[model samples]
Target: MSGAKSVSPENRTVIGLTFGNSNSSIAYTVDDKAEVIANEDGDRQIPTILSYVDGDEYYGQQAKAFLIRNPNNTVAYFRDFLGKDFEHIDPTHNHASAHPKDVDGAVSFTIKDKAEEDAEPSTVSVSEVATRYLRRLVGSASDYLGKKVTSAVITVPTNFNDKQKAALLAAANAADLEVLQLISEPVAAALAYDARPEAQVEDKIVVVAELGGTRSDVAVIASRQGMYTVLATAHDYEFNGVALDKILMDHFAKEFLKRNPSAKDPRENARGLAKLKFEAEATKRALSIGANASFSVESLSDGIDFASTINRLRYETLSRTVFEGINRLVESVIKKAGLDVLDVDEVILSGGTAHTPRIASNFSNIFPQTTRILAPSTNPYAINPSELGARGAALQASLIQDYEADDIDQSTHAAVTTVAHISNAIGVVSLNAAGEEIFVPVVPAETAVPAKRTVHVAAPKDGGDVLVKFVEGNTHIKVTKPEPKPKEDKTAKVEDAADSDEESDFSDDDEEEEEKREKVWKIGNTLAEAAIRNVKKGGKVEVTVQVNADLSVILTTREVGAQGGVRGQLNA
Candidate 1:
C-alpha cells in the first residue's frame, strides 16, 4: 500500500512479473535486453515463499530456509490455490508447511507468529498471501530502480482460468501495482526470443516447453506475419523438476539405510527428510553444470552423517524415464496441432528444469534435424530459460509503457471493438526444388479485419516468369513413408535367417522406412491467380494481400523494382 502511485506517459516506470507457482522473477529493460533483478540477498530466482518468526516477515530464499526448522510458520506452494474453493483444491505439496484449510469457505492457512507452544495461530487467506508476496517483490524492484514502479505486465500459465486472472489482478492491485496486462507464460517466452508483433519476421512454427519446479507445460504456436497463434497446449501437474529431486533424495536415503542398519528411515523423520530434499536439490543443480557431483548432509539421520557421490551419466540413467516422458509430452503437443516432428521450425526450452542437458538431448532425438533448439544445452546464444518469461514481460512493458492507457486498453479488449477476423490462413502456392506444391502463407488465420500482409516471392532458379496463385489454406499433415524393401520369400525364410547379409539389409531398410515419416504440406483451394511476365533471371516478386471488414479480399503483385503492380479484388 505504501508503494502505490498513479502512472502517466512521462512518469511511468514499468516492470515485468512472472508469478510462477514455485518461484517468481522480476525484470526490467534499459536497452534492448531485459535484466532480471536480484533482491538484496542476491537471488534473481526468488522462491515464492514466506515465513513468520515472532510476527516478522521473511521472504524468498531466506523464507525457504525456514521450511526445515519452522515448517509450522512458513507458507509455501500457495499460488495454485488462488481463486479456488478449499474443497476443490489439492494440498499434497503443503504437508511440510502450515497446510491449507477451509476458513469461512475459502482456502486459507493457519500460521503461528511465534514458536511458543501455546501461541495462537492466525488464519491467512490465499489471496492475502499472494498480495504480501507481490508487495515484497514490487518493493524490491522499486528499491533497485530508484523510482516508484507504476505498472507491470505479469505472466500467467495458459491453463489459468478467468477467475484465476481476476484473483491475480486483485492481488496485484492490492500490492500497489497497476496491471498493464496478463500475458501467457509460453507467449512471453516466445517474445523473449524476438517474436515481436511489429517485426517483419518470416512465418514459422515453434514449440515452447516450460518444465518448471512443480509442473510442465508445452505449447504449439504458429508465427505468421509477425502474429503468433497458440494452436494447441498441454499441461501436467504431477511431473517436473521436483520428481527428479525426489529421485536423488530417495537414492541417498536408500544409501544411508544400507550403510546404517540400526537407524530408521530418514524419510519418516520430518527434519531428516527436509535435509535430504535440500541437499538433493543442490546436487541436482550441481549436476546440471558438471560431470559429477557429491551429496553431503551433516547429522542427516539418527546422529549419522550421510555422504555420497554421483556422476552425470548415473544421474541420467536414473532419470531416463522422466526424460522419456517429457519427450512424449512434447510429441503429443505437436501432434495436437496437427503437425509432425519436421513441421516445427524452432523449439524454445524455458524454466529451470530445462537446464538439464539430458532433457535437451532427449528433445534433439525427437525433433527433426532442421528444427532449431533454443536451450543452453543446444544453442550457445540462447537466453537463460529461467529468465525468459520475466524478460519477455519486461520487454513488452517497455514497448507499451509510453502509450496512452485508453489506447492500450482498446487494442487488447475483445468486447469493446467491432472488428471481424478471418477464420483461415491465406497464402500463395509455389514449387520447390522438386517442383512440389508449397503453400507460402502471407496472412495467418484469426487476423482481425481489415488486415494486410506482404511477402517477397522468389522466381524460378533459372530466373523465369513466375505464376503465383493466392489460396485459402488449412494445415493438414500428409505422412509419407518410403516403399519397403521387398519381403523375403516364404521358401527362403530359413535361408534368409542364416544369411547375415540379407538379414542386415532387410533390417536396415525396415528401420529407415519406420523412422522417415515426413509431414508433407498439401495445397488447398485456390482463391486468385496472378502471373508476372518478362522478369529477368534472379528477379523477385512482391505480393501483398488485404482483407476488408466486409470479407472482400484484394491481392496485389509485381516484380521487385518494377512499376505499375497488378491489383485485383475478389468477393469471398
Candidate 2:
C-alpha cells in the first residue's frame, strides 16, 4: 500500500492559492512538475496590504512605503474586514478607529479627510480590496510564466464556515480567477507531506500546528492506504504570532512611556510604534537561535532615544501564556481524536511562528517520544513558511487531477467506520400516553453518514398529534412532574365483620381470590405505514438495516413490485 503514484501529463495547468491573515501565497505545477516564481518585486510573498490614492487608483507595497508621508490617503489590511459584520468588530482587536459599514454583506470603509471635510471622501468595499490583492498575485504569476492563468485551488482555515468561504470564493471570482477548489489549511499540509518521496504509507497520525499572524489551528490527520482523512480539528482565532510580538512590544512600550511621559499621543506615535513592532518581531526570531538580542528605538519625542535588550529566557517567559494555550489545544485535540501521545507519528509545523526555536522546543516537550517536528524546505523564490501552504495546495491539485483521470471506482474500497459497535443506538424522542417523554433509538452516532434506521412507536389512542423529534447526539430525556392523584371515596369502603374468626378468615381468603386485573387491548392502527406514506419523493425509506465493519448503518427500502428494489448505502 505505498502512497506513491505516478501523475499523468495533462493539458490544463493547476495552480494553488494559500491566503492567510497577514500574507498570501500562490504556487503552480507545469506538466505535473512543480514550478516556482517570484513577484515583480523579486519576492515570492507580496505584502497583503492595499493602498488607495486619489483619482481612482490603488496600490500595494509601493504605495505602503509612502504611508508615513501620506497617511490620509492610505488604507492597509482591509482584508481583515472582508465578510465581517458591522457589530462584530471589537475596538481592542481593530487597529482602525473608524469602523466600516456593511454594504451587501461586505464591509465598506471610507477614507476620510484629515481636516474638516468640505470635500467628499471615498468609500471602498472589502471585497474590492481583497480582489485587488488577489488579482495582483494572479497577474504577477501569469506574467512570470508567460501564460494566461485561469483556475486556482485556494486554501482557507478549517474553522471558516460556509458564509466566509462563499465570500472568499466571490472575491476570487471577481478577480477573474476560476477557482478549482477551497481546501482546509491543515489538509493541504497533509497533502504536501504525503507527496514526499520518502513518505511512508501507513495509518500514521500527524498534527499540523499552524501559528500564524492572527490565529492558530491544530488538526490531526490519519493516512490510510492512499487516502488521507481529518480525524479532529481545533483552533483559536485570537492566538497567533502577532499577539506574541505584541506581548514583547507592550513590555517595551510601558518602559518607554514611563521615561517619556509627555509623549502621549497615539496617532503621532503610530509610525514609530509600527517600526518598534517590526523590531520586536525580528528580535523574537533572532532569540530563537541565539541567547540574546538588542533592539533600539531612535529619536522619540524631544529627541530622546530608547534601547532594550532581551534574553531567550525573558522572551520565553513573556510568551509563556501563548505556549500554554497552544499546548492545551494540542492535548485537547489528541484526546478528542481518541488517541494518545504514542499514536501520533509526526507533528508538522507551519506558519510564521513555527519558525521560532522556542515554540518548536515547547512542542517537543509536550509530545517528545512520537513527535518529529520538521521545518518546511525552502523554495528558491518563496519564503519557506508562506510557500509551504501553497506548495501543499499545488500537490493536492495534482493528486485530484490524477484521481479524476483514473476514474477509480470508489465502491470497490471498504467503507471506514468511526463507531465500533452500537451499544446504544440513536432514536427520536416522543411523549408516551401518560405524557412522559422517552427516547426511542433509531440510528446511532458513529453510524455512517446518509444512514437511515427506524424504531416502531405506538400511535396515540385518541388520535392526537404525535410529533417525532429527531435529534442528533446522545442527550438524556427530561422527566415531567407527575400529576397529583385524587383522593379515594371513604363512604364506599366495606367494613370487615368482627364476628367469628372462621368467617373473618374466609373473607380474607375471598379478597385474595378476587380476579387479577389484566390490561385491556386498545384499538389503534400502527403509525409505521403512515411514516412510510409520508416519505417524500427521493427520500430514503427505512426497511432493512445493515451494519458495516466500521459500525456504520445502511438502510434499504422495501422491495418494489416486479422490478428489483434500489439499495442505498451509508456514507462515511
Candidate 3:
C-alpha cells in the first residue's frame, strides 16, 4: 500500500511529478480534473538543467541559458547517470566532458565560484543538484496552489534499477517531499488514456509508445473494465530526443565549418557546440511541423554566425536508422506479448518527442490501421501530451488519498489493481560443459508478481556446501582476461586499439584455443549457501524462489523433495 492511501485527500497536499531525463513537470487534480501546474516562468515543462554561478545555483530555463556562455558550469543529462556508476556504457554516458567527474563512485560536477573568479571551483554531487532542482519544482507548485505541498507521486522509467530508485527517493526526501508511490511512466500513461469518458468498453489490447527526451518506452497493456495488466515492456536507451538532436547538431556543425575555412571547428569549441545544439533542437521541432525550416545561432564560432535550412526529407534521411530502430522495438514488444499488430485495438502515443510527423507516419506504416491510432490531442479534457504521465500520476494520487477499498473498482489507475511483471529471467549459477560458470534461469521474468517457482540443481561431485547465487538481467556476462604484456614497440598499437570503440582486426582461430566465455552476473544481496552434510556427491537440492508485489525476492533451499528448508531474502 502507498503512503498516500492512508492520508485523506482533504487533509493532505499531494501532487504528481514526472522527473524526466531532459525535462520535468508537475500536476494535480482540481474538482476531479487533472490540471498541470505551470512553473514560475509560466511554463508547464521546464528543462532538466542546472547551472552554478559563483557557487549559487540556477535551474530550468535560467540554467539552460548558461549552456553556451558557461558550458563547464551547466549540467544536463545528469539523470541518465543517476544511480549508475562511471563505467555504464550507454552512448550518453560515454561522452566525455570536463564538467563532470566521478567522485568516490558517484557523479559530481565542478563549477566556478562567481565570488572569486580566479579561485578554484567547487565540486557537488549530482544528487545534490537534482535535489535543488526538485526543491524548485515543488516550491513553484506550492506557490501556484497557495498552500504547502508535502506528498507526491513520481513517475520513473520501467527498467530503472534499485540504485536509481533509491537515489530519486533521496533527492525527493532532500526536497522535503514524501514520495507516496514511484510508478512506471508507461503505466501512468495508460491510466490517463483509460480514464477518458469515451474510453469505456470491454477488455482490449492497447499499446503505448512513449518517446521522451532521453528514452523510449513501449508497453502492451491489457485493459478490461477498470483493471489494467501490463503484459510486456520494451525500451531503448540510445534511441531518444537527444540522439536526434545530436544528428541535427552534427549536420549544422558541418555546414558551419564549410562556410568558414580559417575558423576552428565548431565541434572542438565547447561553447559553440552548445549553441549549435540548442538551435538544432529548435530546428528539429520546427521541421516536425513544417516542410522546411531555417536555423541560426549568433556568434556560434569565434564571432562568426551560423545559418542553415533543412528540409523534412533531409532530416528524415539523417534520422532513418533511429526511425527504423523504433519500428523494430515496437514490433519486438508486440511479439514478446504473444500478439500481432492487428491484435492491438488501440495505440496511444504520448510524450513530447512523439509529436514528430515522421513518428506518426512510421506508426501508420507499421499498424496500417489509421483509425485505431489515438493522437495526443484526442480529448478536450484529457491531459496534455507532455503531461500525460504526470497527470495520470495525479489521478493515482487522488485514488490513493480519496478512495476506499470498495470504491476503487471504478478507478482506471493501473497501480491500484495491476501487477507489473519482471522483464528478465532469474536463475542460479551453474557450470557449463566446459566448466565455465553460467546462469541457468529457472524462473523467467515475465511471471506475475506474488508468484513462486521451484527448480532442482545437481550437487558438485566433491559435495560440500552448495552455493545459491541468483542472476538477473543479462545472462551472458563476459569476463575479459587480462592480455599478457607485449613488447614495448607493440604496446602503443594495443593501447590505441583498446581506447577506441571499434573491434580489433586480429582474430584467434587456433583449433585448440579456448572460446571466449561469459558468466551470469548475480543480482540482489543475499547469496544463500546450503550445507549438504550427509548427501552423496551426485545428490540434488531443491530451490524455491518467490517474488512479492513489493519486489521482495525470497530464496528457500532444501534437500530434494524435502519439506523443511533454509530461507533467505535477496536484497534489491
Candidate 4:
C-alpha cells in the first residue's frame, strides 16, 4: 500500500464530464494551471460512441469506422439513449430502436444476431452505459498521466434533476472515480471563460451560445466579488446543427426523387438518404466561407449522378428555422436573466456549429449594440467544435478545486435550521363553540432545527388521535372537523338574545367583578412567562433541528442526551 506521505496534493486530480446533444466529453486538470490535457488520441474531445467486438473487447472510434463495413458488430452515437425509455424511439425514424442491455440507455446500435440472442432483452440503464464510456476515458487519461487518479468533478446540464444527478454519480463510481462535485455545464463554461485574463472583465454580463450537433444551449453569466454565477440558461434539444443538415437533406431528397423516379426499395432509399445527410452537413460547413459549393452523391442505384450546387444565401434561407430557434433561445435566456440586450457586455460563442459564419451573423444581428463575438484564436486550417465544451469543463473543475484549496480555512454558515419540537397545539383562532376560523398554524417548515415548544391545546370533547401533518409555504392550514354544519338562524337568535340581556350584565361589571376574578385566577401566572424565566444564559432552552438529504433530523442542545450526545432520528 502507498504510504500517506506518498499521496500528495499534486497526485490528486479532478476530472470534468460533459454530455451534449451530439457528443459527450471528459476532461481532467493537470498541475496547478487550468490547462486541459487530452488523451493519447491527440484529440481533446472524444466521440460518445461504444461498440463491443468478439473476444469480449470494447471499441470506440475505431469501431465506429468499422460500423459501415461491419454493421452487424458495431454501435455508435449512444449518448441519445441516456434518460430515455426503451420504447421511446420514434417509429418513423429507422435509426430509432431499443437499446442493448450492455449498451444500456447511453445510445443505440445494431449488433450481430448471435450477440442479440445471447443478450438479455431489458434496456440498458443510462448509468451502466455512461459508466463504461467514462471508465474507458479514465483509463486513457491514467495512461497519459502515468498516475493513479481517484477523484473527479463531472458537469451536467443545468436542468438535470436529482435522479439524473444520481445516475451521473453512479456512472462516475462505476468509472472508478470518487466524484468530488457535479457542476452544471453552463456554469462550467462561465468558469472557463472567467479564468482567462483576456476573457475576465468586471461587472460584465456575458452570454455563452453553445451550438452542438444534437442540441443548442445559451447561458447568461455575471461575475461579482470573484464569483461567477449563472443568471439563466435555455436549451433546445431538437434545434441543433443536425437540424440544419436535415433541412438541406430535404432539398436534396426532392431532387433525388425527381431523378430516380423508378427507385422503389425501402432499404436502398434509406442508404441513399443517410449518405445525403452527411453530404448536406459537409456542404453546409463549406458554404460558411465559400459563396457556393457543389456536392456529388456517387453510386446511386441508377448510376453516379446525384449532385447539386448550393449558394450560401440559399443554404442560409433553407436553414432559417434553425437560426430562428437559436435566436429565440438566446433572447429567452437574456430575458429570463432580467437583463436587456444593451446590458450584455460581451457575447462568447462556442460549440461545433459556432464555426459557421451564418450562426455568428445571426447572433450579430440580434445583438447589434454588443461588440464583435470573442472566441479562442485557433488555426483556421483545422477546427473541432468538441474542444470548446471540454476545455470549458476542465477550466471549471480547476477553478472549483482551486477555490476548495484557497477557502479551506473559511467556514460556511448555515442558511437554514431544523425544527426541534412543537411547543403549542396549532389551531385557528375561533369564537364560541361554532368555531369560526381565523389564524391557524400547527407547524411551519422554517422552524429552527431541534426545537421544542410546549403548546397549550384545548381537550377535544371526543378524544382521538390529533393528526399532525407539517406543511410549508404561505398558505392557510387545512383542518378536518367531525361535526356537521350548524344552523345560521339558531346562531343568530342566540347572539340577538345575548345582546338584549347584556345591559344588566354590565351594571355588575366594575370593581367587585375585577376583585372576584383576581381572587379566583392570577393574571400574571402564565406558563409562557414561567418558562422564559428558567431559560439560563448560554443554555439551549430550544433545540436546534437540522434535516439531512434523507429527511432525517438531528437534535442538538446544550445538554447531552442518554445516548451520550445529541439525539438523531431518521424519519420513516
Candidate 5:
C-alpha cells in the first residue's frame, strides 16, 4: 500500500480487463452487475499505445496523437511481439515504430531521441512498453472507480503460451495490480453472452469469431447450462482491421498521386502516411455502416491535400483476400474441433470488424441459414464490438471475487464450469529417411486440455538417442526465392543495327547461372525433449505428451515395454 497500490482491507476494488493488439478496455462490477468504466476520453475502449516526448510520457489518445508527429518514439502494436524473440518476428509485419533490435535474445525497440527528435535513440524492452501502457490504464481505472484498483482479471488469446502469460503478468505487476485470472478471449466472450438475460439455457455448439484490429480468432465453444467451454480455436494475424487499413491506405495514396502527378510519393512521408492511416481507419468504420465512404486529409503531404471516395463494392473487392482468410480460420477451427458447420447451433460474431456488413455476409454465406448469426452485444454499457472480451472478463472478475469470498450466489453468475481444452495442436517433429521434417501431432489442436496422448515412433538403427520434442501449436514454414532475371540479347540488337547476318563472338551462355536455394526456417520453441536407449531397430519408443488447461506441457519417453520413463515439465 506504500510503494505500489494494493487492495485495501476496507475497500476491495477489482477490475476486468481485455488487452488487445491495438486497443484495450476495463470494466468493474457495481451492485453485482458488470459495466464498462469510461476513461478520460469518455470511451470504454482506448488505444493501447504509449509515447515519450522530451522525457515526458503520454498514453491513450495523447500517445496516439503523438504517433503522426513522432512515429519513432510512439509504440503501438507492441502486443504482437510480446513473449517473442527477434528471430520469431516476420520482417514483413514491420511498422512505423523503430525496428525491434535483439537484446540478449529478447525483443526490444530503439526509441528515437524524444528530447531532440534527431538525437540518438534509447532502447526499451517490449514488456517495458507494455508495462508503461498498463500503468496508464490502471491510473485511468483508479480515477474512474474513485478508488485504487488493485486486482484484475485479464483476457488473453487461448493459444498464448506460458512465456506470453508471464510477460503479461509482469506488466500487471509493474502497474501495481495483482492479476487474479487470465481468461481466454473466446471464453470471456461466451461468458458475457451466457450472462445475458435473454440468453437461452440450452446445450449447443457455438462458434465465436472475433475479428479484432490486428488479428482474427475463431473458437468453438460447447455451451451447456449457462457454462462455457472452449473446444477448438484458430487465428489469422493477416486477416484483420489492420489489413483493411492497408488496403484503404494504399487506395488513397494512389488516388492522391493520380490527382497531383508532380507530388512526391506519400509513402516516403512518415507524418503524411501516418495521417493517411488514421483517416483510413475512420473511413473503414464509416464504410461499415454505409455503402460508401470518403477519405480526406488536409495538407496531407507538403501542402498538398488528398481525398478519395471508396464504395462498398470497391471496399469488398479490396478486402476479398482478408475475408477469405477469416473464412478459412473459422472453417479450420470448426474442423479442428471435429465438427461440421451443420453441427454448429450458433455463430457469434464479435470484435470491431464484426460490424462490417460484408464480413457478416461472408459468415452467412459460409454457414447454414438455420445456424443463426448472433450480432454484436446490445448491452446498456455501450461496449463496442471490440470490448466484449473485457466486459466478460470483468464479469468473471466478480465471479472470482465471490468464489473467493465463499459466497456462491446465483446473482453473481457463479456456475460449475471449466475450460476443458486448449485451442491449438501440440506435437513433436520427426524426420523420415529423406530427412524431411514432419510434424507428428500427439495432442491435436482443439483437444481437451488436461489431455495426454502416446505415440509410437520407430527407434533409430542401433541404440540411437530417442528424441521427443514438443511444440505448442500448429507450425508451418514457407520459403520463397526470387525468380532469375532473363539474359539480355545485346548482340542480337547490334546485329539488327548492322542490317546483316553477322553475329558477335560473345556466347549466349556467358552469363553465369547462380544457383538459388529456397531457405525455410522452422518457427517453434522446443518445449520438451527426451533421451531413449536400448531399443532394437524394429522396436518403437512410447512418447507421451500432455498439456493442461494452464498450458503446462509434460513429455515422457521410454523404450516400448519399459518399466519407467523420463519426464519433464518443459518450463524452459
Candidate 6:
C-alpha cells in the first residue's frame, strides 16, 4: 500500500483498512490525499496470516514464513469464514495450513501455540482470529502515526452479508477499532481513480476486476457525479494467481524430473513442494516487470538441486489461457450487468495478480480502443492495484470523519439517483478532444443537482480572447468508414530480388483496418457564454459550471494564470 504522502493521525482519528483473505493494508488521508501506512516490518501489503511457534505469536509477512515449517499451527484463509457456519465455509483453501473444524455448528480452527508434537491444539473462532489480526493492524498504524487510531472505514466485498458485516464490526470493536463504515471494494476502487489529479469526474460504467491469490472477483458499477452504484458482480475461484503459479511449478518440476529420473515428483514431497512453490511464486512476480526470471531451488526433490530460467514470453505463453480466463471473467461480469463490452467506459484492475502484463494486454484486446484500462502495467497514471481499495477507504474516512454516525449512515444508505437533476447536460461548447468544434461536458447528464464541476481546457494555441460557451448537450457516437486505401498494384513486381527483400520492412505496418469510432459532441441549446481575454500563448483556460436544481446555469471563466475574467447566470 502507498500513495502521495499527506497525513498523520491526531487525537484518535479514523484510518482506512482493507482486510483481504491473502493480504491487508492500512491508510490515512489528509488534505484530500491518502497515504498507505506500513507496518513495523516496513511492509505495505502485509499478508493476512498468523502463526504460532514455541508459544510465541507472529503476524503479517513474518507469520507467512512459518506456514510451511509449522503448518498445523498456522491459521490462514479464514477471513471468508467470519460469521459463517461450518456447512457454508469451504476448507480447501486452508488445507496447507490449519484445518478448520466444525465446533458447535460454528466454524473454528484448532491450532497449537507451539510446534511441539505434544502441544495441545486450541479451538479459535474465526471472529477471534480476525479480532487478533485487526488488533495487530491497529497497533502497526498507531506506531506509525505516533498516536492511537481507534476507528477505521474498512472495505468489504459486495457479497458480504449483514451477518458477516456485523461480525466484522464486532471483531473490530474487540480490537479497539471503531467501525466507521464498511464500504464495498469496487466502489472504493472507483473512488481512488476519481481522486487522481488528472481524472475527470465523468459519468461512466466502470468494471473493477480483482484477481486475488485465491479467487477472482469482478464488479460492474455506474459512476455518476461523486457516487458509485454496483450494478453486478461475479466471482471465480478456479482461475487465480495460485493457478498461474502451479503452471510454472509444473513446468520446472518436469525439468527437475528429467535431470533426476529416479527422483519422486516435487508435488509428492512435502518439503520439496514447499520450496518449489515459494520459488515459483517469486519467479512469477519477478517476470511481471522484467523480461526474464530465473528459478533456483536447492534439494527440491529426492535431494536434487534444481535451476532453470524462463523468459517472460515463454512464461506468458504457458499462462496464456490463464490470462484469457481473467479477461473472460471481466467480460462475463459486464454482461451479467445487462450490458455489452461497448458500454464499459473504464476498467480498473485490482489486486497483486493484475501486475502481470499479459492480463492487461488480454483485457485491452477484449475492450474497445476507447475504453480506459487502469493498471500499473497498462495505464501510466494508475496507482498500484493492491493499494487502490485501501487508499479509497482512507479518502472516504477523511470525507466523513467528523460527521455524526447516524447522519453518515443515512447519507450512505440514500440512493444518489433520487436527487433532482437538470433536463440536459450542462457543458461547455469548445474544441472537442480531436480539436473539432463541439460541446464537451464538464458536468455530465444525470448528475445529481445543485452540482458544480471545474475543468481546465486548452486556450487557443496562440491565445487571445477566449469565449467559453455553456450549452445543455449530450454526446453521441459517430461511425465513419475510412476511404479505401489506394490499391497496391500486385501485378507490377520489383525487378531486383534485393528490392523484394526490402518489401518485407513495410509488411509490419500493413495491418487490416476496420470501422473506426469517433466521439462526436452534439451541441444543444446554449445556456450562457463568457469571455476571457489576453490569455498567454498555450495557456490553459479554466471554466466552472454549476447546475442548480431550478435548471439554472452559473458559468465562470478565467485564464488559468491570469486574473478572474467574468461570470454569468442563465435560466432554462
Best by lDDT: 1
- In model 6, pairs of residues that clash are none
Number of clashing residue pairs in every model? 0, 6, 2, 21, 3, 0
> For candidate 6, lDDT tens digit of each residue in 153-270?
8988888888898888888888878776788888888888898777888788889998888889899887776676677799888789988999999999998888889999998866
lDDT score of residue 18 within candidate 5: 83
Model 5 clash pairs? 421-449, 424-445, 425-445
Better of 2 and 3 by TM-score: 3
Residues 107-128 of candidate 4: C-alpha lDDT, one tens digit per residue: 3444442445566433345556
Report the lDDT tens digits of candidate 3 across residue range 370-488: 32666533423434568888888887777676554324333433443356665555667778668887666665645556567788888676666666666664433355554655567
RMSD of each: 5.4, 19.7, 15.3, 20.0, 16.2, 8.4
Ranking by lDDT: 1, 6, 5, 3, 2, 4
> In model 5, how large is the Cα lDDT of residue 526?
65
Q: What TM-score does candidate 6 reach? A: 0.75
State the displacement of the C-alpha of residue 388, model 6, in Å, after optimal TM-score superposition. Answer: 0.8
Superior candidate under lDDT, 2 versus 3: 3
Q: Which has the greatest TM-score?
A: 1
lDDT of 1 at 535: 78
**Candidate 1 has which clashing residue pairs, if any?**
none
lDDT of 5 by residue, 1-572 (tens): 12223343335578899888778898887765668888988867688888888878877878888878887788878786788888986534347755677999888888753577577878889888888888888899999978888788888887888788878878778878877667888878877777776667766778988889888889898764455667778888889898999999988888888888888878788888789888999999999878899888998887898777889888888888888788789989988977677667888778888877777666765665677777633223323566678878888887666343323222232232335555456667777788777667676544545567788876665646666666655533233444554549756645553542221111222222312222132425567677666666677888788776577778888888877889888541
lDDT of 1 by residue, 109-163 (tens): 8888666768788888999999999999999999999998879989888888888
For 126-235, candidate 2 gives per-residue lDDT tens digits of 78767877888888778887886666767888777766776787888788775556677886776666666666765456788887877789887665444455677888
TM-score of each: 0.86, 0.64, 0.68, 0.60, 0.68, 0.75
Q: Which residues of candidate 4, in runs, are more than 4 Å off? A: 1-11, 26-42, 55-60, 66-123, 264-268, 289-309, 375-385, 400-572
The alpha-carbon deviation from the true structure for residue 286 of candidate 2, after best TM-score superposition, in angstroms, is 3.2
